[model samples]
Target chain A: MLVSLAWRNIWRQPVRSVLSLIGLAFSSLLLVFMLSFQFGVYDTIKIGALGLFDGFGQFQPEGYDDDPDISKQLPGSQALLAADQIKGVSATAPRASSFAILANGDTSFGAAVIGVDPAREPAVSTLYSTISEGRYLEPEDSAAIVMGAGLVRNLGLALGDNVTMLGTGNDGAVAADVLELVGIFSTGVNAVDRQITQMPLARFQETYNMGENVNVIALRGPDFNGVIRAAPDLQGLAEAEGAVYLRWDDLQPEVRQMITLDLSTAMLMYGIMIVVVVFILLNTLYMSVLERTREFGGLMAIGMRPAQIGAMVWLELVFLSLLGAGIGIALGAGITIWVENVGISFPGMEDVLGQWGISGRVYPDLSFFSASIGPGIIVGSIIILGLIPYRRILGLEPVSAMGAA
Target chain B: MKPIVSCRGITKVFGKGELAVHALRGIDLDIMEGDFATLAGPSGSGKTTLLNMVGALDHPTAGEVAIDGQPLSGMSKSALSDLRLNKIGFIFQAYNLVPVLSARENVEFVLRLLRVEPAERRRRADEALAEVGLQGMEGRRPSALSGGQQQRVAIARALVARPRIVLADEPTANLDSTTTKELVDLMYRLNQESGITFLIGTHDPRVMEHSKRHIEMNDGQIESDTRG
Candidate 1:
């Protein structure tokens, strides 16, 4: 009966009640949307970066990352042996990579030429599997180059087209070579697809006069657990050669740092929303307590304890908060799912995100854990705020309360 | 007869410092279990303050006030609330009904707080409302009822608990003369029929005339206590 009374009291001022509800809902929605956007961008970057690159962890030769010179290559034999010793290491590939300028007619662009053992490369990176149309490199196809789709277009080159590569070789002499385009790889990351060309290891060595050197050996691990398990020993080994063992995280510290900062920003923005919601609840409940002060006194006047009055008020708030939160959570989840599916595309901002190495379409990716936090915090805030008005029950002046106002 | 309420040298002060108001000064009184007494005084003459002290709603600044023979002065707040709840009922000038509750729920409000069984509470609430001549009006909210009807509901609420004493503070202030006469007569009938003690504080002459006893207050003190 008290619940019915309180529920009816809330509707006494229809406009105020609705305004409060809308304020809470709007606050909850904004918080959810911000969090989803941050989470979505994080996943998109992680997926895109790992697609072209190797695993969660990588093993490279001494000074290869800092200098990346072809002259710094570790012998393929030693790299293979070290790759085998890393626990949780799923697969590894030895690659000979170098910087060169490629030319076709009047169009010329700088490119990173990668020489991979094609069979093992697929195990370490998704580059071979992401090939949109043409076949990936094969062991017998040593002399051929596989270019990015966009790079192939910009150079006006295609399968069986000829391209020239020029570089200062490992011997400190100028060198040049011509190669046929055997295939194309599209990893959906524009930078890699537009500027990288893959060839077989022996052929790249022969053409670039690199002799028997391999620039870096990259590895793909099992999962998040595998990366953590293998990091310490791999770091130790890389340091022995004065090299840096970089995991996917180390490859882009700024990206990870930005994600951490963005998540905190998501929390701060959403925290402001939650606080607004708390105030709305407090206003509705306080107004309700004021309106019903006399009724509370009447109850106390006739054999009803003040504690009972306090309990009724608390119960009423719990019921209303549950109702509001139920509505808010359902609305938030509906919005989250809708946004996660079709994604929100910022027209002019796509290039901005692309420049930051983020995707153009913002897909809101909400974890089960992340989505659950919102309602928990909202309900908790309501309960904590509900205590303020209960002081009326303790100091309830029955005569004045029953008298008027 | 043993006194149902007793006040000895009870005084109540309001506000503080230079702006302080002394509403009641050294009131001493007692009423037997079956008395139908009215505290008659002009406005600000300390009648309401004495009544509040006797009803356990306000504490005296000094000295003692007791209800049902237990001292109310030094008892814990919860203890006083218990004394008020289990022993006393109150009716106010404005009828103080919860606007959102139906007449039945208003009465049930006390019964539920007292943890009365649902079926018993409904039956008692029905009987009380009927006794106040409000049969078949249990479902109406206070706003839907007339002034007289709402007051009757307040009486029913006070009486439904079957308290040993009922305190009325200007219970007929807003009622028309005819309605006031009817309400006083109903309360008198309840007193006669049920033997419940009644203590009414009012300035209305009609209320005093209808009462079986009257105590007149002057300034901060009672000047006369008369019994018919």
Candidate 2:
């Protein structure tokens, strides 16, 4: 009977009830989209940073990350074979890098010269696909280098131009080579474009006097998120070889920090939005209670306990909030699924995204958590804010409330 | 027989200091079991205030009120509510039927408060509504019923629990003369048939004419008391 009464009472002011429902639904929709967008941007950042050259993560010689000397190389063939055997690892590429100087005629600049297997490197790094000019290195291309666009400009060199490279070799001798520029790649990172170069692995090994050895073994999988979940397995593989495994967080701490900060800010904003929704609900319930003061008083006069009256009011709020939240969840899930399938792109924000290594197109994440979080908060807020009216009902004196005009 | 409702020197002050309005001043009243009494007074004459005191709906400032020998002065709020629910029923001047409920639902409300079994509550609500001449209109909401029908529903609600006493404050004020007479006649018949007591506050002469006893008030004090 109480439930029936409460349900009917809600429709007494149809316009007000509908408006309140719409407000709650709008809040739910906003919450769902905001959380989805935030997580989507985080995924984008992880892919952009980890996909450039390192794949999901990398396994390096214990001390090679701190000092990439020619002698500090791992057994490349053995590590690559072992990494390939690990489950969930889709691909692995071995690379040797050294800080060297490139010179072309009167122009010269310092560069991080990276040695990579031409055919296998493309399978692990997005750098292969981001080449702006010239073709990527082929398997048979010896003494050939792929320079960044900034590096090419700094050294005044063009594609197919011979450039002299000078660095220390594994034998403590001066390693010198004249390599033809086969590719000029631009990854949109100014530092990488201006100071990184890649060459065929055999030629690099011969020039650096490091035979069949490399500084790092990069691994790739279907997705970086799965790779993160497989971190324990990756770590075991690294430990078996006396190597150090570096995930994206370990490789790019700054980007991780930025994501954490951005997430915190987003949550704070969402929290405020939730608070606003709660206040709107409070106002709606307060008005409903006020409007029915005499009715409640009559109920009390007829021997309705304060707690029972409170329960009726609470039940009304639960019904209203859950109805709105349910509708919002359905609407939000539909929009998210559609947006996830087609993707969203910011045409005018490409430059801004590029600065952070992210692409222009973003795919919203459609996970269970994102789908439920918005409606969950609204329901929780309703349960909590329902207490306000319950307390008001408890404090109402039947005689005074009955006399209220 | 002992009086069912007893009030001694009941004084009710609404405000304080110079702003105080003495709504009831030194009122003494007694209502015996099975009595049909009317408290007659104009607005601000304290008839409703006295009725509220006897009904345990308000506290007297300087007096004692006892219903069925239980003094209301020190009783807890819940106890007073229980007393109202189980021993007394109230019918407001405005009819005060919960607008959201159907006629049957309104009649069954007090039974529900008393935690009566569902089947018994339905049976009692149906019987009470029939007694009030609202047969076959039990499912109609208050808005769907006429003023007289709504009042009948209110009467059914008040009588459904078979309370020892029913307190009514100008119950027929909104009804036409014909409906008012019918309502008064129904109350008189219920009093005679069921041996239930009634304390009504009204300025209407028709209500007074039907009552077995009439107590008139002026300026918060009883001015005349007459028995039929």
Candidate 3:
């Protein structure tokens, strides 16, 4: 009877009740959608930044990530073959990289010289697909190299021209080479486009007197999650080969830091939304208590305890919040699923987004965490706020309350 | 046995200091089991104030009230609620039926408070509504019913609990003369048949005429106490 009475009481003012319900539902939906959108954007950043050159996971010499000196080399072929045997790992590419200087006709520029396995590099890196001009290196080509658009432009060199590369070898020998620029790529990332050049791994080993050793064994998988699941196995193999496995986030600390700051800002906004919802509930319940002042007095006059009345009132809010949260979750899940399929696009911003590793469109990722945490806060707030009216009810004297206008 | 409803020197003062208004001046009264009594007075003459005290709705400034031999002074609100639910029933002037409930639901509200089984509550609610001449109108909400019909529902609700005493405050104030007479007659008949005590506070001569005893008040003090 108490539940029935409380349920009926809400409809006594239909418009006010429905407006409050809609307010709660809309707030919950916004939180869920915003959370899913953030997750999707994070995924976009991870894929874009990691895919360009770092791959999802990588095998590097124990200290190469901190200091990329050519002397710090690992047996890459053994580690690459072992990583390839992992079920989820789709591909692996070996590479050697070091700082070097390129010169052409009195023009000179410093570049990061990257030696790649031309036959297998395409399977691991997005850089191979972002070529803006000229062709990538071939498996049979030893002296051919691919340069970024900005790097080649700065060197004042064109495709088919030999650019002189000068650096120190592992034995402190003067490593000198002249490489034909076979391709010019544009990745939109300033650091990559302005400072990188790739040549065949065998040619790089010969020039640097490194003897089939490489700096990294880059691993690729179907997606980020697949690579994550394979990290432990890859780590074991890398350790055996005197190297260390780096997960995507470990490989991109700057991206991880950006994600932390962005998540904090997003959560702050969501906190404000939850606070707004709390106020809406407070307003509705306070008005309801005041509006039914005489009615509450009447109930109390006729043997109803204030606690019982409070329970009835609390039950009303419980019903409202449950309905609101349910509707919001359904709506949020629907919108998120639709977005996941069709994706959300930002037009005329592809160049800007590409720099940060998000292609033109962002597909939202809806996880259980994103979907439930917001609505749980909303529902729990009502359960907690329901006590205010209960205390108010306890204060009213039946005689005076019944006499109230 | 003690009187079903008892009051001794009950004085009620509202507010404090110079602004204080004495709503009830020390008065002693008792209505025994099966007694039908009416408290008659003009507005602010203490009839309602004294009734509210005896009904355990408010505490008296001085002295005490006892219903069914249980003193109301110093009792917790929960204890008073339990007393009211078990020993006294109240019918107000405005026919205070929960607007959203049907006539039968209004009567069952008290039974629900008593924790009566649903089937038993339904049986008693139906019987009480029938006794109040609202047998067929049990499904009508208060808004759909006439003022007289609403009063009948209130009466049914009051009696359905089978309280030791039923306290009615200006129950006929909002009714037409025809309905007023019918209500008084119904109360008189229910009191006689069920042998339940009744303490009514009203200014209507028609209601006083139906009561077995009359206590009239003036300036918060009783002026006359009459019996046949």
Candidate 4:
């Protein structure tokens, strides 16, 4: 009976109750979508920051990443075959890297150089797709090289330009080459475009005297989670081959740092929104109790306890919260699910995010955390804050209250 | 018969210092079981204060009150509420029914608080509404009823619980003469048929004509006690 009474009481002033309901609903809706969008971007960054260059996870000689000496090399072919057989592994590439001096005519620049298999590099790293100019190197072209647009420009060279690379090889001998630059790529990263270059693996082995040994075997997967699941299996493979497996988070601490900072800032804004919504709803509840002072007194006079009156007020708030937030969640989850399918696109914002190897569109993650946490906090807060009006109703004396206008 | 409602040296003061106004001043009174009594006075003459004290709605500043032989001074708020629920019914000048409730629901509300089963609650509520001549208006909310009809619903609500007494504070103050007479006659019939006690506070002399006993108030004291 109290429940039935409470349900009817909220509709007594339909306008006030509906308006407050709308406010709470919208706040919850905005929170659900924003939190989901934010969660989705973390997955995007996980791939863009690491999969763009570092290949999600890696297998390297135990000390290769810490100190990339030519001597600390692993069996490239064996490790590559072992990594490719993992269930989630989509591609694997062996890489040999060394710093080299490049020159074209009167210009010269020192640049980081990595030798990669022309066939496998395209699958493991996005750098292959960023061929801003001429075609990528073929497996047969041992003398062909690819250079960042910035590196090529700094050397005063272009496509089809012959660039001489000079470096010390693993044999402690002077390694020299005059490779034709068949491709110039622009990675949009200042570090990569300004000072990085790549060449065919066979040529690197012949010129640097490294045989079939490479410093690291990089691996890629279907997605961030797939690659993560493959890590344990990859770990076993790496150990057998006397190397260590490095997951994306361990390989890039800065990405985790960036996500944590962004999430913290979003949480602060959500906190403020929830507080404002709760206060507005609380005001509505308080005023309703005040307006019914005389009626409450009459109820008390008949037989109703102050505690029963307080419980009625509480039940009213609970009904409002459940209705308001339930609708918001339904609407929020619907919108999120739709966007997850077709994705949210930033039509004119491609160039802004292109540098990070990010596309113009993103799909919201839509996990339980994003869907439930916002509305949960909101409804919980309204119920807790409702105590103010409940306490007020409990304190009313029947005689004086019945006399109130 | 033994007194169903008792007040011994009851005193109620509002505020303190020079601002203190005595609402009820050292009044001693009792209404025996099944008595239909009325308290008449002008505004500020303490008729309502005395009624409120009798109903256990407010505590006296000094002295004690006992309703149906139970002392009210030391009772907790819950216990006082239970006492009121079990022994007293109430009617107000403004017809203080919960406006959201239908005429039938208003009567069932008290029975609900008493934890009566649903089938029994409905039957009793229907019977009370019919007894007050509001049977066909069971589904009508309090706002849909006239002032007199609303009072009748309040009367039914008061009696449905079979309380020992009903406290009515100027219950017909808003009604016309014809409606007032009809309402008074209805209460007289219910009092005679059910043998339930009634204590009323009013300025209406018409109501006094129907009462079996009239206690007139002046400056918080019983100025006259007359039997009709």
DockQ of each: 0.53, 0.62, 0.71, 0.81
Candidate 4 lDDT tens digits, B36-108: 8989988999998998999989999998899988889989888889999999999989888998999999999
Give the Cα error of residue A346 in candidate 2, in Å.
2.4
Q: How many residue pairs collide in each prediction?
A: 1, 0, 0, 0
lDDT per model vs. reference: 0.79, 0.86, 0.88, 0.87
How would you encode candidate 4's per-residue C-alpha lDDT over A249-358 as one tens digit per residue?
Answer: 77788788888898899899999988888888888778888888888898899989999999998999999988888888888888999999899888887766665566
lDDT of 1: 0.79
Off by over 4 Å in 3: A74-93, A118-123, A134-141, A225-247
Candidate 1: tens digits of C-alpha lDDT, residues A1-405: 556656776677778777766766666665566666677778666655663565556666666666788788664446453665578777777778888899998888889988888878887777777677678898788678899988998898878888998877878787678888888876656787898998888888887687776777777766544666788877777666655677777766766887788878877877887777787678877887887787777766665677767776877677666666666666777888998889888887765665454556778776665565776688778877777777777777777777657
Model 3, B1-228: lDDT tens digits are 469877899898999999999888888888898888999988889888888898898899998888878889999998888898888888999887899899999999999999999999999999999999998998999999999999999999999999999999999999999999999999999999998789899989999888898889988898998886
Residue A44 lDDT in model 3? 88
DockQ of 3: 0.71
Reference-based TM-score of each model: 0.81, 0.90, 0.91, 0.89
Residue A95 local lDDT, model 4: 86
TM-score of chain A of each: 0.71, 0.90, 0.89, 0.85
lDDT tens digits, residue span A1-405, model 3: 889999998888889888888888888888888899998899889989999999999888888898888888876467465687697899899888888889887988988999999998988889988888888888999988899899888888888999999998878999999988889999988889999899999999999999988888898888787888887888888878778889998899999999999999988988888998888777877888877878888888789988898888888888888888888888998899999999989999988888887777899889898888898899998878888887888888888888778
User: What tens-digit string does per-residue lDDT give for candidate 2 at B16-41?
Assistant: 99999999888888899989999987
What DockQ does model 1 achieve? 0.53
Error of 2 at A249 (Å): 2.8
